[model samples]
Target chain A: MAGKAVPNATRRSERSHRAILDAALELVAEVGYPKLTIEAIAARAGVGKQTIYRWWPSKAAVLLDAFVALGERAAQEAEGPGSEAPYAFPDTGDLEADLKFVLRATVDELLSPTYDLPYRALAAEGIVNPEIAAEFVSRVMEPSVQLYVERLRAAQQAGQVAADLDPRVAVELVTGPVTARWLLRTLPLTHAYADAVVEMALRGLSPR
Target chain B: MAGKAVPNATRRSERSHRAILDAALELVAEVGYPKLTIEAIAARAGVGKQTIYRWWPSKAAVLLDAFVALGERAAQEAEGPGSEAPYAFPDTGDLEADLKFVLRATVDELLSPTYDLPYRALAAEGIVNPEIAAEFVSRVMEPSVQLYVERLRAAQQAGQVAADLDPRVAVELVTGPVTARWLLRTLPLTHAYADAVVEMALRGLSPR
Candidate 1:
């Protein structure tokens, strides 16, 4: 009877975990992070607050988990039908085309309503809370950023990128303008804008 | 008698305004923005809540004014001593050197404790509050960013930058990486990092 109950308990824990994440995401979207309380999350999830505390330490931790779950969903959607392979920059040997394709997808993600509210809230909280912000960066941002770094490294090996170029910094040059435009709302973040950034960062502004 | 009293009252109001801004800055630094309250600011400033409300609509507005005041002070200091000219990028005809010099100063400003705390609070708040964030982007970020746009436009006309490059987008490529590094704290924002960004940006990362 003890062995039989063990699997059932584990299943209950997993269901509770998903409910908490879903509740946290909905509450953050509706009320924003400052007002998002653990009690509210627990009530929304239909679990006791102790159930939440048993697994997560704080609201920030709960929100971070939600965001991670959301990102995983996005990646799966991007990968699409039967492509069990994880999402990566497609290197078709034409660097510009591959970059443009990836950037266009990024533009779509940034513009998507599903991702926008939570991402903005998470980003805002991270700015003020250094520890929470660092975790968000390490867990969510770095993994995707590493893909860019890897692509740049591949380009360098292929002699497409400059031998001296640091792949990490090079990736920033490509992605930075898009992010700045998105965050600052300085201009329209369109496919054309993405294409222009790729061209400028690749060929540079200097007339070579 | 009424005419003479008007200037005295105006002077008193101005004094109160300064005090309120000072109090707001101190309170925000000590308590963080989420914990900061208008009542607390009033108490710290030795003024009534009505006095703060008369001058600014909300706590965010008060903090915004404080930041504007700080920017003015930084600009004044940047112009002091050997800097005979007001705050403009030195057009030394070498774009790389001019960019490097300006970015190094930016690195110093972002890292300074005096500016970092309040700036982080305001930036974080702005991310969640679209209206406030838009005002900040327009009032604070744009004016400084325009300096870069102006410099790039001048460079473009002189055949230093690509003639077809949009000055606005070009400016982002230069400034975006620095801001991204600072905001995300993904890596050490150092003088070396600043220099590398300028190099990768100005001269495309692609093999020359």
Candidate 2:
């Protein structure tokens, strides 16, 4: 579906797309994923249902796009201008600091009331819906996970990370704990928690 | 609420409680959480709804107990017989090997279709419902998370883990990754993945 409607997507179409995404997120936060409907999203966006359907096949698809856009925007805003890549991990020759930065940002986002409700709505849907879960893994989650994998590979090449470790699996070692803490939620999420995760991940759990 | 129930739990009451829990699990799996009802549970268990309410305050309470019982049984079976505790981590003075064993079993449980469906149902409920989420963390999740904390502290005293590390947060260093890998299903959950998490967590990601 890439570039299938590029000619159709004039500047006005981009405005409408953002409006629909915003509307979808608003409605999901208000009523949750189970009750969110295409009609409501279109009405709230001041667009017709046909317009929403023309761009995305389902509400879940629209939400997938909405969250991806939201995450990227958050990442870009956090990184500031003149950065090489928005979501890519920084390589100042310090893997621990870089990981903590990204994870702390994640903690902030997860703790934000605005992001929390809608994301949880989508996550609830994803838990039951296989199609949405697959789309999330491939389109949203995997790409983000891959960024860390890329950064870890860079660390390996720089001789900071162990050469024998698989970067993909190693990425999970950090991401897993952070996401688990967020998802399960027995304690308040903080930069301190993120720092600990980074330290334990970098300097082994055994005595340094 | 704990030992007090033993005096009231005649063989008949014990049988009734089991039936209700079973009915709740079956109904949740069959129709999902939103549709599950005490009336339905009562009908399925061949008991009156009053009988259920007499023991548990709500459907959520019944489900929490149901899941707890299920988890304990699984842990007991996995640990073999004569273990000091059902869900407690084994300390053969080898933190890495012991962690891998528990994590591998977790991988097996997460991958099981029976456990997967009901858990997803309850977890989906927990995600949106604040009260249920709190109950889940305090009751279901924390008990198990504490076990890891205990094991980690044991390692710390033995010099197998860092002296300065917080066992509570350190436990997430491993649990976080395993749950994330399970919750976000881009990769297959397996013993190999569990082993990778264990190794990275204990040995650190750096060249050392």
Candidate 3:
């Protein structure tokens, strides 16, 4: 049914691309962002440095791609095979329950060692490196963050949230605490934590 | 500081210690964390390697001290000299106003490039290295964080915050958004942002 047959050369190149990305992810986790190098990545991937250079602009670029790929893989695993839709914050009529559902999944993802290691590396680099930080936010973080924003907007319309509230900032009430606990690790990142955050966000901390 | 001080020797050692911390901060900002080293810090500080090792355990430790020193300096500058009390969250009896004041101050600190660069480096390293992270949290972050817990507790007693909520987790509602905004740079870290976070946290985002 296809117009053209896939060439062996193209397929081999695709394999090398995936291998290079995987190698980049592993090396960053093992040695950290400071020690990771193109040569090490090349050796680990069994590819020439030139091949990598032909595609990615730098080591951080490659790692960002790898991180995205890993996140996509995680998302795919959650939804079963061939799922292409990005993560959506649930919109059950009960806003608190939906938020708790999403934030709890987020807590689980952030605490996982496999994702956590490479993410920490990338995030650390992003903090100091403005260029990478911007890209990481726009490309990787913002999309998911927007999911929360959209859900908040919907809740506001449903009269679960105040109509005048900025959905962007309101989303932060739930997400910010989740993120803080997740990043700081001062307290346990648990479903209980997510529930607390959602309840606080919805009920307000003041005596109601 | 107490009993057995040889004035000249003690003063000189203190000077050298300050110099090492200053150098550590400067180099981390300039080269980023990955390139920072003990030798470089020594050279920058005009001290020998032994001088540094005599005082701090590692480059990370030195930076942590430097960051804390910088923060203390900022706090002192804000309150004027001879202010012994660390930054206490304002207990103006208006919970929203007090939180807004502190979070606004936090926004300014995070956005200012002077503290931001070195802070970013340390935070990045802390993410990957659990040892440094724990120390950074316990030593640098926790004291200020405790201020929030105390303030929230006061609010609870005063009939401001809901008594059932965990003050520890509730604090995250204020902190998380500030941190997420600061770290991501997806939005401007500003007073307005702090105001929004405080409003959302206190009033609840839902129709109240």
Candidate 4:
């Protein structure tokens, strides 16, 4: 078996990687994170348990990869026609419109069934498991959030946002309600709600 | 067994109830929600599994009750002197001060070791379990959120907030960052953070 496994077996290894990730995501969506196991994922993926062990440290690692893949795909789909891949928020010099546009896309993603189940399971798991949660945050949540931070910083430079505003907290003001509503199920996560959040956050809650 | 179970049964039942809750909380904190079981709780509480079964439908129910009890105790301790049982947001006719006060208290609760462990466990459980999440929202999260809604409504009526603003979404502007900060561990949830959130939400994120 050791002799049969070559150092340059790139195609076979890539096939196994895809299979493992797909199996991990399906199992997590079906049985949830707690019941998901390496044995089960390997069996479902038609790979040996050793094959999975060779690449990933734990089930959380597999799930994290699956989630990142899903997010990347979603971002690509949300990008505009003839746009470059891995799209950034458009700097139209109109902060409100740009934010509203991005938030509307976010609302759609949050509401999508494909993204919702696995992501929710991962997020729930993260809440209790600090190690896994840290991975999820650093690998998945923080990178995307930094996009908003970058956008806000640009806006600040342009005098659209308050110059002294903390871009991190400012990004949260825009993103937080969308997350809170989806996570808590407090209200319908509609485009209207997203628009309202952008409006309120950008315009302030107090009367003008 | 039934006939002999009457003497001090009421007192015994109350004691067992408290014991069961404590045991459930401890087990969840130690081992997490999926590994937590009725038998373990019963054994830890010095009661029969049947006793737990007779009272609650599932481990989620036991944890939920335990969380409610914990929150109630925390509220009692946090309430001010001459306060009417700290259930609602205290409307002292100063929106900013009232909001800052409540959010600072929330920051303390989120930071405190006593509340963090079991609450995080239950919140983790609630995220994936829709039924439990609904119960949590309707019973705990919403009622607390509604206090903000009520306060915002009063602010709207007082012309402090825009008449067109939805108090529901308005409340999220105030509450969402605190929750985001706590859940994401993105920043230190200090009184200063709470104060900044209050200022940002009240004044809006727009440039003056």
DockQ of all candidates, in order?
0.77, 0.66, 0.75, 0.71
Best by DockQ: 1
Clash pairs (backbone) in predicted model 1: none
- Which 10-residue span in candidate 2 chain B carries the lowest summed lDDT? B80-89
Model 2 chain A: worst 10 consecutive residues (lDDT sum): A81-90
Q: Candidate 4 clash total?
A: 1
Residue B119 CA displacement from its true place in model 1, Å: 1.3
Candidates in descending lDDT order: 1, 3, 4, 2
How many clashing residue pairs appear in each of the predictions shown?
Answer: 0, 4, 0, 1
lDDT score of residue B177 within candidate 3: 87
lDDT of 2 at A63: 86
For model 4, residues A24-47, the per-residue Cα lDDT tens digits are 888987887768999999999999
Docking quality band of candidate 1, CAPRI definitions: medium
The 10-residue segment of model 4 chain A with minimum total lDDT is A80-89
Best of the two (1, 3) by DockQ: 1
| RMSD, candidate 1, Å | 2.4
Q: lDDT tens digits, residues B1-208, model 1?
A: 5778889998998998999998888988899888999999999989999998987898999999998887777677867655432367778989999999999998998999878888888788887777888888887888878788888888988999989888888888889998878877778999999999998888998898
Estimate the Cα RMSD of every predicted model relative to the unseen true structure: 2.4, 4.7, 3.0, 3.3
TM-score of 1: 0.94
TM-score, one value per model: 0.94, 0.84, 0.92, 0.91
| Model 3, span B7-43: residue lDDT tens | 8778888898889888988898788877899999999
Output the worst ten-in-a-row residue range by lDDT, candidate 1 chain B.
B78-87
